[model samples]
Target: MEKWVVALLAMSAYLVFAFIVGVLAGRGRSFWSVSEYTVADRGLGLVLMWFLMGGTVFSAFAFLGGPGWAYSKGAASFYILAYTCLGLLPWYLIGPKVARIGARKNFYTMGEFLGDRYDSRAIQVLVGVISVLAFIQYLTLQIKGMAYVFNVLTEDAIPIWLGALISYGIVIVYVATSGVRGAAWSDVLQGILMLLVAWVVGYTVVYSFHDGVADMFRGIEASRPGFLTVGAEGSGMSPMSYTTILLVSVIGFIMWPHLFTKSFTTTEKKIKQTVLVYPLFAIFLVPILFIGFAAVGVVDPAQLTGPDTILPHLVTHEMGASGIVYGLIGAGALAAAMSSADAITHGGSVSFGRDIIQPLKPDLPERTQIWIMRLSVIAIGTVAYYLSIFGAAGLVQLLVGAYGSIVQFAPAVYGALWWRRGTSTGVIAGLVAGIAVNYYFQLVQPATPLDINAGILGLIVNVVLFVGMSMVTNPAGSRADEYIKA
Candidate 1:
């Protein structure tokens, strides 16, 4: 069979599997209820929670961007592993508390929790706007990843836009119908498949290039001297950049809306246990870096159009068009893209429907609100699909800015749970200042005022405003007293 034919078969089979899982998940359930659809009735177990969390975190970045970074930048690629492991560590302490509050308050979205905590509709609106924007940006990246895989693996037999539409259209239908439960179950299957493929491809590339793993490293050391060592000379990234990236990712990881909303889907114990086992997921990515290293001498970085396309190019060229292996790689890449997309699409809809719409229109019926949520999923999915097709150089900047700005939620989140003195004025002022600073640094001036990340700079300003404002402003009187009491 032709390689394109084999690739098409592989992707189609994976989509079929996902659709089946999604349909099955919706069966015999009370799909009409908002709680059931959004949070699976808060009844997810440890096993499902583990895979859901792992699968959500390991997106197209792990499969494609991880190795590409390793191949192109040397030791800097280890940032993938460092950030993944460290990012979830603090969640152990924070996850259960958020879960407890969510369960007690019947909160289904992060915006709900923040709004109720602050007793301010404006704060909720601000969070809702940012969540929707960030999630849409995130969805665009996932669509692009899927488009790239389909286009390249099929040798351009399928156009990029059509490929993205087909893949994500399935996600929209399933998520609108089945909700979070459908996303979790499909993630389990995808998570397992992608992990297996990462190991197989990583080892295969090393064995093909050199005698063994040790021999491959030996070759690297001889040619690129210190390439295997940390802080290697001639490495494209500085140690400060490496350390900052790791710190930012780790601290900012759980702040993501999709990850934050998952807290409402499971028990506190299950959430903690899932976090404990989540670090193992980081191990699956180490081999992907090996694939990039294997391509170091064989492939020229300049010849490659972009870092994200390197992995697909390697599999199609190096794997010799073997039907089954090519099929497996395609399946794995599809899993990576689809798993992340479902969660993002779902989270974006929930934020839009609950945080922005329902609050403004208190008279909206539950059934109508549910319909709005479903419609928002399709609308957001279509917008992202079109954006991905056009493509943008600013995507990287947009994502970094979003992540950095979103992490400003850290103070609000942590303050709500532990600190009694935190006030509404403090939280709102801090968030605005942080996001404004982050935006200015990212867009207005490409360089940070002092070589720090824009988000990091924003965070510093956020802290000052938060502490200073709280000292001067009074709380919301009876309303604030009642919320804190609750």
Candidate 2:
């Protein structure tokens, strides 16, 4: 009868539904083979691939941090729109090639793809280390977003840590048991649920105060000018920073280990099709900006401690904590968080097993490797859970930090695919240099020439060093030729 009780019930029900879906989806697959466990035996069709990719991207950030950005940062949030439109275009060109090679080489991890290209375990190890760190960082943000949703909705009936433990625990179990198949099927539910909830809730929040979406924005402009456009001097980020962020995101997004390895889970054509249909997913996310913008003038900024909490605050206060409304919000937010967590957690585990553990043992049985991957979920999940509660960084900060590191992978990945002269030494040097430059810009300087994104600046340095070293160094032509033919 009470609001918290209804919300608790709704969230609990959603968890049960997710667990059932995860387990059932993985039911008939052979669990003994590493490929079966990690890539669903490379049999995912177009629809499942579509939802899996979409659900992975429409993360807890999209639900919480997205609106938070809109609420706090204004026009800077439009960068998400810009990046989403342009990001996957490069994937259409690269994904099919990667998928074809992955099928031939029996590669299920991004590290495997690159390490083989350069004939270097060091490359795999580098990718493994970077990917694991980035995965934990990413999972931490989503878990925080998830926990925040639970804590705010139940009025702390479910505290942040406990809420994370309960929901993320489902993610661990499903991923450990079902592997990528579990993650993909659960994403089907999550992808559809979240898109619907985002639109409904976005419209609801806007219509609450103003007659329509346009009126809502107009009122915000009248009340808080410069909140709708970038470089407006209030909450707007620099235009140079905005455009650079979009450019780096478009280049680096598909380079994420989870998204890159996804190429292995389906056919080459399916990979292309996934990219072709992704713009619709981009369109689906626009209204979430409205939800964030809706709360700007109406809610006092001083009242809430952080912008990340703004959306939840709106649901609890503006929706009058209505049982059904709050319940749907919980279900949707849970979908957003859990969906992304499962893929990331699974990808981290696979990277650890395929890249880290399997190479160390070399002769480890396939079954043993699968077990290591399954157990790696708990290991990585524990780290992410602990960090989610204790980490000092905010949601957007963590996501941005992780993105900065991930884009550095592009040089190695693209070199393996297209550049015949891309030597192992050169790729390794470039990756290290890129990350170093990125971190230096990120923490030490915090300002770049012309206000370009730190990541892009890092990429420029990375590319120069990579190309220069490759020109002087002997090309790994035969290996690259083999890859190209695949």
Candidate 3:
């Protein structure tokens, strides 16, 4: 069979398999139960929680973008690997407490949790808006990554728009039908497939280009100095930028509504176990960077359209691997993108209904809320799909922008847990100020005095303002202490 045909068939089979897994996993749950839809009735075990949380973090960015960074920026790509291990460790300290409160309060959304703690509906709506924007930004990149793979692997036999629709459409269906259960089960399959495929591709690419791993690194370093390590003294990213970016990501990583809300899906013990096992996923990502480095000397940079294009380019032009290998690589890339997208789509919808719409209908029936969340899934998916196809921003830029905005939520979240005095006024003001500062740095003057991301700089202001505002305002006599002590 022809190469494109083989790859296309493999990708198609992968999607069909994923769909079956998703639908089946959601089976036997109560159709009218909002808890079932949003959190699998808070009954996830250790194994499922492991995949659910693990797969959520290993996004399309990890698949395509990880390699892209390694290929383009050299050692700067190591920043991704560095942060992943640290990012989820804090979950051990916080996840159980959050989950316990969520179980006690019947809270399904982070916005609800925050809004209740601060005694402000306004904060809920504000978080709802932020969550929606950040979610669409995050989902757009995953859709774009899947589209890029389909476009390249099939040699444009599948156009970008159509490819995105086909892939993301499956995600929307499973999420709408199965909800979190569907997504969690799907992650079990996707996380396993992508991990295996990454190592295979990473190892194969290195050997295909040179004698072995040592020779591959040596060849790239000899050709391009300072490309294999982080920070200056090397010709890579500045040390401050590298260190601070990782810090921003690690701190803000759990603050993402999608990841944060996972607290409601499983037990406290399961969440802790998931946190313990997650670093292995970080370790699993190392070989992905190797695939990028493997392409350095072998593939001409001038032929590539973008850094993200390196993986597909290598598979088609340079790997000299069999047709099946090409097919598996394509499937693996889709698995990465769709696995993360389903969870984000599910989480975004729940946030929309709970944060944005639930306030409009506080007395709405549980069945009604469930339907609204399902509808929000489709609506959010459509908006994100449109942006993915037409948006001018690159994947990395969109991700960075989303991260900058969402990281501002960390102060409010952590404050809810530990700081008893944080009021709604303080969090709202801090969130607003953080976003403005972050936007100015991101768009108005991207080149700051230092190589620091605007997000990190914005975070410093965000924390300071939050603390200052809370102290001056009358603190809520709310159950801030109760939630903390629980």
Candidate 4:
């Protein structure tokens, strides 16, 4: 058989296996139950929770963009590692509280949790709109990664749009049919597969191209001086930019609607355990960066299409026609992209059904809501697919841009949980102001004052408005006290 054919077959096998596993995961679960489809009945075990959380966070961005940053931006890539380490710390304190409250209130989405707390439907609708928009940006990156892998490994036999449609089409089927169970179970397989591939590929590429890991760095350091050091002269990123990005990530990490809703998937004890063990997953990313650094001098920058393609480009060209190597990289990259995409897709559907549709109609039947969520899987996937193909931003760039808006939810979330003075008008005003300021800085003006992350700047304005308005506005009465007590 030809090399590309053999490689394609290997990738095809993995996709088939993932489809079977994902579909079967929903076999015994209640398809019509809104609770079952959205949060696995809030009974997920520790192991499943670990992989679901890890796999969802470490998306194609980590597998592809991690190396891309190392290859293109040098040490600035370490921000990914830094943020991952600190991001979940706040979750430890907040996750249990949110889980307890969610369980009591029968909350399955962040919008529901906030809407009930602040006593405002407008806030729920705003959150729904923000979450779905951010999800599309996020899902776009994962689809791009999947399409890039199939197109490259298959030698472009599978066009970008078709490849995305095929892989994500399977994801949509299992997610729509099986719900969160499909996403969680499949993540178990994907999480294990991608970790094994990352280390093996990272080790092989380093030695294949250079004497060793140490020698690989030595060559780059000697040739490109300061590329390995952040904020150094010629490093491509300044210290303030790096610092602000890191800060925003830590604040915004768990605020992601998909991740926040995970608080309802399992118990409070398991939530803390997941957060504690989450840092080890960050270790898996170290080797992923090695793959990018290994390519520094070996591959010419001008020849490659984009920094994100460096990984697959090296695997196909330098691995000497070994179909196994091509297949391994293809499956692993797909795993990274698919794992995250499934969860985001599932979350987006739930958000649409629960936050946007239910609040507006208020009397929609439970069965009708489930069907809407199921159909939303296709609708949301279609929008994200269009963006993935047409969007010009880099993977990490897309992620950070999404984070700015998501981080805007921080004050409202924290206030709902702890503060008694929080009022509906205050939450609405803060959320709107924060989102507007964030957009203005992010899109309207790229050059921010003092080089702070646009998200952080918006957050500053958001806090002021939220607090100032709440003090003047009447408290939410006994309901606010009851919510905080819960």
Please provide, for model 3 over 1-486, each residue's C-alpha lDDT reduced to its tens digit, 9 standing for 90 to 100: 888889999999999999999988878889789999988888988888888888866788988888888888888898888788888888888889999999999999999999999999999989988999899999999999999899889888999999999999999999999999999899999999999999999998888888998998888878887877777454558878887788889988898898999988888788888888867988999999998888887777899888888888898887766779878998999999998999899989998999999887789998899899999999999999999999867777788889999999999999999988898889988899999999998899949667887888888888889999999999767678877796
Off by over 4 Å in 4: none
Candidate 2 TM-score, true structure as reference: 0.98
- The collision pairs in model 4 are none
User: Candidates 2 and 4: which is better by lDDT?
Assistant: 4
Q: Supply every candidate's count of residue pairs whose N, Cα or C atoms clash at under 3 angstroms.
A: 1, 0, 0, 0
In model 1, what lDDT does residue 263 have? Answer: 86
Q: What does candidate 1's lDDT look like per residue over 19-50, in tens digits?
A: 89976877788877889888999998777788
Q: Candidate 1, clashing residue pairs?
A: 87-250
| CA lDDT of each prediction against the hidden true structure | 0.82, 0.88, 0.88, 0.91
Q: Give the TM-score comparing model 3 with the true structure, all chains together.
A: 0.98
Task: List TM-scores for all candidates, in order.
Answer: 0.96, 0.98, 0.98, 0.98
The count of residue-pair clashes in candidate 2 stands at 0
**Candidate 4 least-lDDT 10 residues:** 477-486
